[model samples]
Target: MFKKPVNDWKTSSPLRSSDRKKLRLKIASSYSIDTAEADVLVPEGILSVKFKSYLNEPGVAYLAPDGDRDPLWFSLGKGSDAQREDALLIPTIYTLWKMPKLLPSLSTPKAVIPIISGGADLMIPGVIHCPPSLNEGQLVSICKYERVDIDGAPTPMLSVPLAVGRMAVGSDQLQDSSQEKGKAVLVLHTWKDHLWELGSKKDVPPSEPIKTEDGAEENEDNTNSKAEEEVEDKSNSEMPANLEPVLPEVKTPTYTPDEVSQLLHMSLVQAITQSLSSLPASAFPIPATIFYTNHILPNRPHFPELVLHPSSPHEPPTADSPSTDSPSPDPSSITIKTSSHKSLTAFLKHAEKSGLISTKAPQKHSTQTDMLVTAVNAAHRDVETHHSFATIGEIEAKAARKAAREEDEKKQRAAANLEIDVQELWKPHLDSVELFEAMGESISKQYTAQEVRSLLNSYFATHQLVNPHDQAYIALDQALTACVIPKPKSKKKSPAEEAPLDQAKVEFMKRDELLKKVLNSMQNWYQVKNGDMGDEVALKKGKLAPIQVVMKMRQGRKASTLITGFEPFNIVAEDLSEDLRKLCAGATSIAPIPGKPANSGMEVLVQGKQSKSVVNYLVGKGVPEKWIEVQDATKGKKK
Candidate 1:
């Protein structure tokens, strides 16, 4: 279910001792493992996290006993309900690697492993071997047969499980192998899926070598031979034509230093002629780092053998191939250092001599020392005649992938910028309490203007207060009059100057004007709501506080920007701090705002004077400009 990266992930408090114990029992019972094993799998001090799959259905609760980074088990339910026995606890790939025998395994052909990893259900015909006692609906591990050398003899051994799923049908149904045609196992988690990406991302552990007595190896070899014979006999009749054993990977080609230099020169020519030729005149004088990374690197030719199979032998000193004894050098790492030239400066000097490019030295005041690529000599002999080793389709595909990645990143940033809408509302004062009560609402509760008008209309209908002479007016009663009229300010006066008290005025008011006066007489409040699911509308007394961004001078010339008021907007302090660190390229910290309640909110402190940057960032994140107040103490005081 976790095919794509999870977006709505939330970490909850560590599980209680009682809850942890209950979860342990549930896992043991559900997986039919020993209580002791379950204890190790899920120990005390376990933290729980909730995350939704790409489908954004009901979220799954992940238990991370080891730490937040290594979530071992996931249960399909709310975080609080994880302790239940029916939580459907599923072990992650990391957990499966630790305890390979945690579940019964079904052996499939080596060719089928990739298909299964791609999220396809294992067909009955693909199963090379199955445990006789396997039952339907039981969780199982899928494994592939690997040819491991044992005592100088090649023996097909079962590799570590690469996937986990439940059996679609029991072994009894598969007795007539030819008759079994449907899916064998319903795959759940796979090796390189999103769930696996959540962990340490370590490679699958190698299968342990079988150790035996002096003559045991021979007997074991014989048993493997007989098993292979049986598999061959069955495959001959039922196996699909396309299903074949995985072949050994071909070795990558190596090159001498001179050859490497030539390749680098050709790549540079291709980069200049094809990649940089289209740059406009305004884009001249690009930084060497950007030119190399964005243009030169992508235009370089890729070794198909090395790209397709990373584990291929890097040895065997063929005249053209790479040495097998050493690992292949990373294509991206093929810089001037690896070429005949000692450095980028020398490489660029040689290119300048060849009349293929122009370069400029760094300015004296610039922070960086790298030279700039001033212009490309597109009409030079080398640039005009260079033939690109990388195909047109490959270049186009790479460009497409880069564009897609950039678009996805933009989408992610937009998603992270949570926009909260805090609406202003009003609560009735004691003088207007009777009116709200008559309309069936608590006097202390807040209401929007529309809601207040609705309530007033209901009250007017019940009281039959609509003016008969003019439909636009409303006849005011004692309760309505008290709520819709402001009390005149009492002025201190001398005895002789005091005037006779005036009787209560206006018995009627325009409906709109009466509503306006009622709202004015009530206390001000605010209601906040965001886009996140299951969040309650937050109501508070007084006006909604704006996010405060203040730049304060610290320890002489150094300055720090402190921001507060994120709680109401549902922004996490730690997340914002991390984003600021990346955006501003400076250190950031989060601390509880001083003088405020522990739960009020957190303050994000970023190094240096970043008040303006912080304000712009919040505005980009959908916070209204008026909702952010920036104060700069570093600025000089007015004369």
Candidate 2:
């Protein structure tokens, strides 16, 4: 009853080119349902061929480190139009393979991919189009081919289609080129091991079979099938709430303090490997272990193995720690032992020579202050440098004038030169320039010429006798001294004060008078369609202004208590209740809130006594009693 299935299907691996050609023939035969002619795998007509410049190509991919789990190269693609901007284009199958415990579908817009350069990790946006037939644990092959005109050699001109597939077992290579047939010249050169295993019936990992040879059909199935697969995977792939992503583990380096500090400054993981090459055998090799465990591990919350040590170097020394001892008989200085010392005796000897573990007794605070004063006096020096306090020619002219005056007085003294050093005078100018630069342009604009001169003068004066540290404090003090506070002055009063207006003195427009008369005259009023006025309008007959209608309507209701559920204009004649109809019929004038459905004739009153039942009802409905205002018009008071 068992019949052999057709062996006409192509099963060539990408690594083999000769087998690929043979496989192509088989693919062509098996693809067609029609059995009339030799159905060979043939290429559809090549569309426009695009050549991507090596430096300008959108996608730039590199290889990952060897030890990384599921080592994959990362590729970044630039936007087609935006210059120098790159983004990740994550393949559906490759993303799912990289994260096998989860399912990926069209809905997943983002993915994490391995970046080969420096073993970096990249977060990329997912592609909307799902891949066909490829499943988890597969390598993604990116293939493009192009023809080359090498040394006037003419190669075979054959039509070939460009194609790429996810690998089930090993790494896949990617090639980029600029040609149609050349693009398909992806010469794969390996045998399909799966076909050989089919006959033996051994255990094989679950894999989705390739659907068809026609790429178009495969593309169509990719969308719907991925959705279904994702739904199916949801239940099976569920992990604990605390489960997190794991980062690849790396080796630690043996680092000395200088080396460790240098590596910390560099932020290079390879620095650990380099550091280990120079470390002495006695010191533990643990820079990568400590640095990564302390800083890197925390950054990767999903990677728990990164947590290695809990204690910092500043913690208490251990049992075998070196002894704490005094240094040699140096009268003036003290020294301490360095952590790098080999042994206790060695550390003590070095500390003694360096005056760290000193033999001299500690000085009292008053004695220390006296020693500092002596040091300051010894450091002072008197040296005069020439300055352009006045220009060279000006100094010469002033000297000549002084000489003539002194000769006229009949007293000839030695001629004193007033020439100042240009460099010394310009020091203040240079300092001013630095100050102006530091304050930035906006602040510099607010300074007046006098203030600028004062600042410059203070800057130069401090430098003449003091060091930079003391000069800063002097400059600050000078600025504070220069600041002036203005005193407040009393305001002058006018001779006459305007009096507040009384009711009779208040001015009224014609419309205002009409409004008062209209309200006093109205017996009943209600909203009606303007279209139904029929020339005998109520407002016209009463000689009432629109403003009066609005004012009286406001008087009939608390401004905030208008009917809210429906628009006033939408309330037709049929909506009027019997009580409202009677109220309107009894009065010749009425006023109702313009936006409410209530009838209006005389004043309507709302009263509240705060009964326990009423309070409970308001509370049940989540209403605040403070928001409800009750007014008793009869009593002329608000409650």
Winning model by lDDT: 1
Cα lDDT listed for each candidate: 0.70, 0.25
Q: Model 2: per-residue lDDT, tens digit, 1-639? A: 001222323221122344333323442333221111111111121011112323344332211211211111122334421112233222222222322322212111111111111111111111122234434334333211112234784221111111122233111111111111111111111011221122322222233221222343334344433433433333322211221111111112223433322222222222222332244545432332233323222222121112111123322322345111111111100111112442333433433353322222225753322111000011112101111121222343576697568554542221111111011011112223334443232322333334444554544464442235543322222222212111123235332321221222322223233223322322322322223334442221211111111111234552211111122222222232223334333212223545545653222211222223323332232233442333433345544
User: Which residue segments of model 2 deviate by more than 4 Å?
Assistant: 1-137, 141-165, 168-505, 508-639
Which one is best on TM-score? 1
User: Every model's Cα RMSD, please?
Assistant: 19.6, 35.8
* Backbone atom clashes (below 3 Å) for every candidate: 10, 30
lDDT tens digits, residues 1-639, model 1?
A: 666677788866688888788888888777766454576688667777777777765555555654336767876545436655455788877778767768777777566676677667777666655667678888898887656777997755677888888889887665553444677788888888888877756657776433332454455455345444444555232334223222222222345455556666777778877768888989989877667656665565665223223333332333366443433444533455456775667777777788878999998999979989899888888887775575333665886798579767876766655565778999988677877877778887778999999998988888999997887899989888777666556566654544343354778899999998888888988876664633677677876788888888888688999999866666778889998998889999988888988787788999998877887788776677778888877785311
Supply the TM-score for candidate 1.
Answer: 0.37
* Residue 294 alpha-carbon offset, candidate 2, angstroms: 5.1
Clashing pairs in 1: 253-321, 253-322, 254-321, 254-322, 314-323, 314-324, 315-323, 315-324, 315-325, 316-324
lDDT of 2 at 501: 19
